[model samples]
Target: MRWTVHGERTILDTPWVRLRSLDVEQPDGARVAYDVVRLRDLAVATAVDDQQRVLMMWRHRFVTDTWAWELPMGLVEDGESPEAAGARELEEETGYRPEVMRELIYAEPAAGITDSRHFVFRAEGARRVGEPSERNESDRLEWIPLADLPGMIARREIVSSATLVGVMALLLDLRA
Candidate 1:
């Protein structure tokens, strides 16, 4: 069952997101308008140290009003490659620069609602150079044992989808 596209219009466009309205014929042959969100691609880094611990940050998200532990991640800026963006975001968010970064996984967190792709990378052997770029984003940074992931997720401590997926990928890699 394919919807026939009648027309489409850009409702709003911005650096972060673009909103579009599309007119299409439904399965019942009725015409309707649907809204779509176009977002920039994001990069997430799962930085693991020599001790085989995953680097994580504890921060408060204003929109969700919850404090959660998450991996370092950010949007891939224009003209930047996913690998570069992952390294940049890792350094910026955690103040640790990875010596080796490899793409681990790529996923669409919400394919139904948004057009945003998240690239997850495995960063091995990172070194803390200095303090985080700022203190507002994260109040504490720590290396958590991978074995503790299940408990954390069950407790709702790790809520970010990118972070969860990245950690699961890391765990799978370890098992393999």
Candidate 2:
């Protein structure tokens, strides 16, 4: 099933996000209008050390007004590759640099009303080189054991969708 776009109009355009109004023909031959959110694609990195621990950050998101464990992530800047963005975010968020980085998975966190792609990466051989860059993004960073993820998620400790998907992808890769 496919929908044909009749026309589209931009309602709001900002540097960080854009909202568009789409007029389309639905798959059932119905005409509809949808408010679509256009956001920059982001990349999240699951950095694992020699002991198989996953690096996580405890950050408070103002929009959600909640603190949760999240993997190092950031928006994919214009003209930058996902891999590069992942590496840059890993360093910027945790002050750790990975020697090896590989794509683990790609997902759309919300597909119905938004167009944002998240690229997850597996980074190995990471080492802390200096203090964190003092960015206003995170409060604390820690390396947690992979096996403890399920309990953390259950307790609402790890709520970031990209982080969850990234860890699950790594787990699936190992099981395969």
Candidate 3:
């Protein structure tokens, strides 16, 4: 069964977020106003090296007030493709440019309330061209061994939805 969306009214509209109330009709014949959050799509890069390690950054998320490891990522700009945005963000945030990138996963983490999509790509390899241009993106950059991912995740160090999905998929792939 699928819910029918009669219409939607915006409660707030901004560059970063859009909030709306949707008039929906349930399959069982109940009508309700459902609140939703719309956010800019994100592009994420999971860059791995020859040694089975992935490039990551330690950063503080002001919203959650927590520091954790994450893949280089950013919002996809209006005129750029997700791949291009991922490559640009990788260099800007980590000073690494991927030689080649391929789509890894797509996730709508909070689909229950938010329509934000995360596009994750795997970088075949990357080279450091210079220091990170985005000064406040992260506190430090490191190449973490993939073998340690389970422990890190267990410790709650890798917490971002996109990062978790991408790395978990990678881990799952290794089993096949």
lDDT by residue (79-159, candidate 2, tens digit) is: 999999998899988899989889999999899889999999998788888777858878788889988988998998988
**lDDT per residue, candidate 1, 1-176, as tens digits?**
88887988999998877999989899999998888898999999998876778999998999889999999999998899999999888888888988888989999988867889999999877888877885667978999988898899999999989898998899998888
Better of 1 and 3 by lDDT: 3
Which residue pairs show backbone clashes in model 3? none
Write model 3 residue lDDT over 55-150, tens digit each, in one string: 999999999999999999999999999999999999999999999988888899999999999999988779999999999898699999999999
Evaluated with lDDT, which candidate comes out highest?
Answer: 3
Clash pairs, candidate 1, are none
Compared with the true structure, all predictions reach lDDT values of 0.89, 0.89, 0.93
Q: Which pairs clash in model 2?
A: none
Off by over 4 Å in 3: none
Ranking by TM-score: 3, 2, 1
Which model, 1 or 2, shows the larger TM-score?
Answer: 2
By summed lDDT, the worst window of 10 consecutive residues in model 2 runs over 130-139
State, as a TM-score between 0 and 1, how close model 1 is to the true structure.
0.91
Off by over 4 Å in 2: none
Q: List CA RMSD, all candidates.
A: 1.7, 1.2, 1.1
Model 3's alpha-carbon lDDT is 0.93
Better of 1 and 3 by TM-score: 3
**Clashes (N, CA, C under 3 Å) per candidate:** 0, 0, 0
